[model samples]
Target chain A: AQSVTQLDSQVPVFEEAPVELRCNYSSSVSVYLFWYVQYPNQGLQLLLKYLSGSTLVKGINGFEAEFNKSQTSFHLRKPSVHISDTAEYFCAVSERDSSASKIIFGSGTRLSIRP
Target chain B: DAGVTQSPTHLIKTRGQQVTLRCSPKSGHDTVSWYQQALGQGPQFIFQYYEEEERQRGNFPDRFSGHQFPNYSSELNVNALLLGDSALYLCASSLGLAGGGEQYFGPGTRLTVT
Candidate 1:
């Protein structure tokens, strides 16, 4: 089984400022990592994923994340943020080999941008 | 192509009532997964269906059941709905035997239990 923990429940940043949302996971085996964003009243939208290869993954809306295997962390980052970027972000994990595996998600990190 | 689509964008029901939510997968996708998102939390996986069979399920109770059709469309049925069941039901579709691939999500169906 895999479990995800997002260290921050909420993050507030001024417009054009950089921000980072921390996430950590625990799994016995190799796993697939994913970052998803949910806007107000909308379903989740995939931001990016780390299946293999590079530890640094770039996603839509100028967002990016780094998968640090040694620390068991997949932290999301953005050099600058806008008011439109305010939303809820989630980190998720699923076992790599199991075809029928279920994704375990973190509680969430709400990003609030102040203009 | 159209992304995953869910019907009855919003609904309201009383306690003890049964509710069914529907979903249509993205084009060429065969696997569908259901999730429940509370007001301020991330989505929790309910189940996954592939080839008209349930392949995986979460820790939800037996009241949460699902069905997948030949066309890859699916439905989630919740029996004896409680206030806790009131949430945004999301449907996601992916193209694979397993649901670990990239998934496209629907706008979601908001179910409110009174």
Candidate 2:
């Protein structure tokens, strides 16, 4: 079984400031990593994914994440944030062997950007 | 280019009651998965349907069941619902096998059990 852990439950940042949301995972086998964002009353939207290849994965809305194998981390980062970036962020993982495997999600980190 | 979609954006039910939620996968999608998202929590996997069959399931009980039609649409049914079952029910869709591609999500059906 695979599991994900998001260290921060909430993070507050001012507009134009940089931010990072930490995520770690545990699995016996190789896995794929992903980051998603959920706006109030809406379903989740994929921010980026790390299937293979480059360690640095970029996504919409000026967000990017670095996959660190030794540290077992996929921390999401943004050089600058906007008020509209305020949303709940989730980190997820799934096994690489099977496409049918269920994706497990972390508790989530609520990002609040202040004007 | 429609994404995944679910019906009854919100629903209210009482404990012990049974409810059904529906979902329509994105165009060209053939797989659908259901998840439960409790307040202040991440969405938990329920089950996945492909080729009109359930290919994988999570730790949820048998009380939670689902079916996929020939058109690739799906329905989720819960029996003897408990207060704890009150949460947002999300339906996601993917092409081919679920693991190989990204899953597009629906707006979700908010189920409130009183």
Candidate 3:
């Protein structure tokens, strides 16, 4: 089974500051990666995904992630974050194909933006 | 069109009782998957239903069951529920196989087992 590890539980940052949420995955088979953001009192919204092709993938809300196969990591980053970006972020991993519809997610990282 | 919507946003039940939660998938999505999210934890896959049949499932026990209708709506039923079942049950809809499409989540049904 594929599993994701998000190193941080909470991140406090000032508005417009750069931030990085680290994620690592463990899987024996080829896998797809995803980042999802859940605002308070709402469901999760996808931030970005890395299926194949380029190692770098850009997503909504000025967020991006780099897929490093050798390191087994897909980390989400933003050059400058806004207070609106404050939310709980999750990193997920799934098998390469339809053989698996399950997506294993990290515990999640709460991003708190300070004024 | 409305996005995915779940019924009974909040529920309270006693241990050993049975409960059912409902979900309507996003328009155009044929696949519905259920997940359990504990407080401060990530959502864990429960099962996936496609074409009115269960196509895939997670590690949950048999007490955790589900059904799908022709309209692609889904229901998750927990029989003889345990206090451990207290969590936010989320319903995520996808166009088809997960690999070929993105999954969208519903607001979720918060179940409180006492």
Chain A agreement with the truth for model 1, given as TM-score: 0.98
Scored by Cα lDDT, where does model 1 land?
A: 0.93
What is candidate 3's CA lDDT for residue A3? Answer: 83
Query: Each prediction's Cα RMSD?
Result: 1.0, 0.8, 0.9
Per-residue CA lDDT of candidate 1, range A2-114, in tens?
88999999999999999999999999999999999999878889999999999999999999999999999999999999999999999999888887756788999999999
Pitting candidate 2 against candidate 3, the one with the higher lDDT is 2
lDDT of 1 by residue, B37-89 (tens): 88887789999998999999998999999999999999999999999999999
How would you encode candidate 3's per-residue C-alpha lDDT over B1-114 as one tens digit per residue?
Answer: 999999999999999999999999999999999999999999999999989989889999999999999999999999998999999999999888757368899999999999
Query: Where is model 3 more than 4 Å wrong at Cα?
Result: B98-100
List the candidate 1 regions with Cα displacement exceeding 4 Å. none
lDDT of 2 by residue, B1-114 (tens): 888999999999999999999999999989999999999999999999999999999999999999999999999999999999999999999887746378889999999999
CAPRI grade, predicted model 1: medium
TM-score, A chain, model 2: 0.98
Task: Pull out the clashing pairs in model 2.
Answer: A99-B99
Query: For model 3 chain B, where is the 10-residue window of minimal lDDT?
Result: B94-103
* Residue pairs clashing, model 3: none
